[model samples]
Target: MAAEANADAVLAELEALSARLTEVEAYLHIEEARGRVTELEEASAAPGFWDDAEAARAYMAELAQVKGDVGLVDRAHERLSDARAALELADEMGQDGAEFIAEAAAAAEELTRAIDEMELSSWFTGEFDHGSAILSIKPGQGGLEAQDWTFMLFKMYMKYFARRGWKVTVNDCPAAEVIGIDRATITVEGKDAFGMLRAEAGVHRLVRISPTDAKKRRQTTFAGVEVIPVLPDDIEIEVAPDDIRVDVYHASGPGGQGVNTTDSAVRVTHIPTGIVVTCQNERSQIQNKAACMQILKARLYELELEKRAETLDEIRGPKTEIGFGNQIRSYVLYPYQMVKDLRSGVETSNVDSVLEDGDLDPFIIGYHRWATEQAE
Candidate 1:
């Protein structure tokens, strides 16, 4: 009876904590500032709204008030998450229900102290992070080896996502002749998928022996990874049919072997932006067309988001630091094995493990902390 009562108490506490956590997550995910901004907008729609000095003052004042409320909610959410994490850890480790309560109490207290030491960092908390992501990997310099390295990277990420139990779907795989990949895009679907992959948006550099060379010399290669948020259907994007040029082609394998007898591949090019998206993964031409259009919309949406940034300096620009010229992270297999994230300056000398299995939590947390510092 005592044990049952203890279990009930713990569950009750957890239920309350979960409710608070959900509230915080909602506030963090959506800009609550939108409400106040909307009010200001509605006020402007009123007759002589802009010209009325008293009305303008009142609207601006209300906007500021809502902004403050939103910030408070965001902070509360971060604290709630930390508390819940501590409680979860304790619950997993405790022997019995009563012990779980005692352990959780201590853990929660410790978390309170830890969180008090610093401000919360959570820049990756956008509506996009809640959805899946599209990761595009393309090889940079170096010869046939570079292409081979890109293929290796493609496999590495696939293995990583597989280990995490995340669903991965390859949309396109443009293969190289001898031994490499020209370009490839993969969709990783899971909870907080974009947040997990946000750190991988930069360049990746690899240094190793060239198997193709008669002389096994050390070679350096680069690959660029572009991570884009997969927008949902609710997020409306207005694109006119006349603005796009759609092409149909028979899909083929690496060596031009016709995989589909019919023209099942669809390529959609945004005429205005010159953004081209191709999809041949689906067996049906109609499905491929839909897939291509989905990617096209995502890319265009990302472009617009970037454009809205305050200045050109805020943008990642043309070059991705992920590769030969620049690198946000590196995986070394020869001479020494190590994995490092340049932005966070975090590293682990377990290249084999990281490549074989994707354990990116450390890197992601580091990047999140770093992003928070930048904002401060």
Candidate 2:
């Protein structure tokens, strides 16, 4: 009976260890190592990528981050491998060894948890997750109430990023006349920023009693969100100056096709790439063109990168609406305060608390699990 007990423990430990190693090797080690190697090779192939000091520094920084992740996962796999070997040795030696049984059992549990964490990290392998993400929010129907709701959505995300220690930068914001934002785009920068925010790249619907309406009617409002990954400057998809058709126009607040004063709005069209970007926030045409060009380069780089990956299914359409009609999440305040993420099917009854300042870790965790299931 004692011999059987020892054998049972040994077998359990070995099984656990084997499972852990398999998870890490399959989920993280192989793919992460391969990705790092590919980046290094591509960086080497691009001659004069280091010509610009700032761009060179950024490129090196990215390479270092990838290398660091690879090294960490490699070391973890090595530890798991060692534990597996130890368990195997104990299994062969028979039930006489108590110390070996205890050591293997403890190591097996540790490896299991570590492997699960690594598997979670592996789902962030999407190329866009490495860079900053651009988030745009626009109001839908319901006049001032819709505008106010848009501002609320903006604040919710900003607060979410703050809780996660992520940096947020507002690129352009058109303030509404009375209450909220007319339209806005912000850049959220941090590790896996795009990955975390990808779940938010759809229409947001809000239901509430409109204070603006004298009849005290419950109104539904829609807000559109767009998320784009910002690319590093070393990306070399060149746009010839002559191939770009430049158009200068006034930057107005909100009217028909043409508005604002000074012809500060600048639009650039790259004929070859069929890419167009416009900037009207800057005061001068030159500054607008420069900003537009910067965004254009990043967008074009993202396009090329997506083409290489052949994974463009996550990107949403230009316009977004809310509720069961066309939205990924719905914020309900009239009937009850709740927020539901459609993709991950994660919902919370405490909408106010979530919007006020929950870390959004639950949503991310849910999304990661869903993505892993899909991949499998």
Candidate 3:
């Protein structure tokens, strides 16, 4: 009787998982993804398809994604079937059903994890969700404390990217006088980098004992994080020469010595919007100008997204403000250690692990689900 009861429980759990898998399949439009995979496969096999290197690479990447999306459901079904078979075989040997029940439980847990990941992927429906991201962190209030906070954020993100197996390139980092960084820009490249990091935008508040203060008082500091998607090569953003000012100067190092002999540093200002972008990391003037233009385009794209969000807000209601004075997350390290996300109500007392060890998935997942719910 005991063996039978365990088997029944395992079967019931497997049944529920099957139902959830069905829902996931429907939500993911598995049939549509399969069709896309077929189309991409046919295109990839066509003659001269590889002639256009960029287009060929994009097609192959899309094909892989579609196949993987479809495979998730397929694999889950296979696991369910295997679990059922194992349970049936164990039932024949009634005395040893517990071992098989354990296997079934493990399989069920795996399926649940896969389903959760699929659900998260479903929330990435934004236009530029799958692209690389350009992220910037700037100090706000609290003087040098804010600068130190900004640098901490920069390191946290770098660690987070490393954990994700993403590549990060520091585009620009200017150190502060006493400690930490004044401003930093980084490029994170990986699958769905922009989609995940976009949730990290806005102000981040930090409350901690000031190391720079003599009295050892708790200080509240603010740092702004901006994440923008790197536009694909196929998308063209037009910026007229008449509407921009271009400045060229020699690139300088930390000690104010000229890093390059020529005037390689380029600063481009969008006259109408008064947005300024500079690129001095590259060696040649042409390269710096190109990099500056790319950053400018990304900024413009972000502005357009904001405008669209505002229009949508007019229809729905007022949403959280995007810029200064609107902090999304707060890290407290003074009396108590806690990291909390204001919008998602997700908080964890493991502040040190979050800041030092780069445990950010919980907050990211919470915010993603919250945003998805709001969108729906």
Candidate 4:
């Protein structure tokens, strides 16, 4: 009787999982995704598909995403069917069905998690959400404290990317005279990197006891995080040669022999917008110049996006003042340890885990849901 009861419970859970999976499939438009996959496959087979490398890459990426989405639903359905069949076989054999019941329960739980992830992914419907991202962090006010805060922010984000299996390359990082960085630029590459990190753009406030101060008093510091999507090759961004200025200088960092000996760093300034980008991470001047250009283009693309949105305040420039209500989130480690996102109303007291360990999924999920609600 207990085995029969356990089997019934497992069957009930499986039914619930199947119903939820059906809903998820409907929401994800699995049929539409499959159709798009078919279309992309046909296009890929055409001889002219590779003529435009940029468009071909975009199509392939889209095809992969759509196929993955459809595949998730199909796999979930198959797992549910297999679990059901196993349970039935055990029952027909007049044997203990506890093992099959446990398997069914585990499969149901896995399906639930998969569906939730799919739902979260569906919120990323932005124009550039599918591409890589250019991220920059700059300190503001609080003197040395702010500089240290900037470095801390940089480390936190690097850890976060590492946890997510994403790749991050530091394009430029200028060290402060004290013990931290003045500003840093990084390019994060991964699936939906832009979509996931775009919400992180804005001012971040930190309150903690000053490690460098002798008074042992609490201090507040600020850092600005800017995230911009890397524009695809198909996007036409025309920057006239006459509208920009380029300068080369000696790279300032511990590197190979020629890094500090010669002028290997490149800085590009857009005359119209007064936006300047520098790249010194690479050893070669040409490589630095190319990296600088990539950053410049990403900035320009962000400006274009802001213009289309008709909201300049939404995407603040690199030099925007960071204070007061400008901060989207705050991390308090002094009087108490708490991290809170104002926009999403998500708050947690696990400041150490968030900062040192880079546990940011809760904040990201909250912000994504908030942004989706705002969009609607």
RMSD of 1: 10.4
Q: Give the TM-score of candidate 1.
A: 0.65
* Tens digits of per-residue lDDT for model 4, 107-219: 77777666666767777777777678999999887888998999899889989999989988888887777767878899999878988897788899999999998999999
Over the full model, what C-alpha lDDT does candidate 2 score relative to the true structure? 0.71
Model 3 has an lDDT value of 0.82
Name the Cα RMSD for model 3: 4.4
- Residue 266 displacement in candidate 1 (angstroms): 1.8
21, model 4: CA deviation in Å?
3.4
**lDDT, candidate 3, 11-86, per-residue tens:** 8988988898888888889999989998999999999999999889989988988898898889988999988988
Look at candidate 4 and give me any clashing residue pairs: none
- Per-candidate Cα lDDT values, in order, are 0.69, 0.71, 0.82, 0.83
Q: Backbone clash tally for model 1?
A: 5
Across 329-361, the per-residue lDDT of candidate 1 in tens digits comes to 887776787888888898999776666676666
Report the lDDT tens digits of candidate 2 across residue range 265-312. 777898887876766766788877877777777777667756786664
**Top candidate (TM-score):** 4
TM-score of each candidate structure, all chains considered together: 0.65, 0.63, 0.80, 0.82
Candidate 4 overall lDDT versus native: 0.83
At residue 371, what lDDT does model 4 achieve?
78
Ranking by lDDT: 4, 3, 2, 1
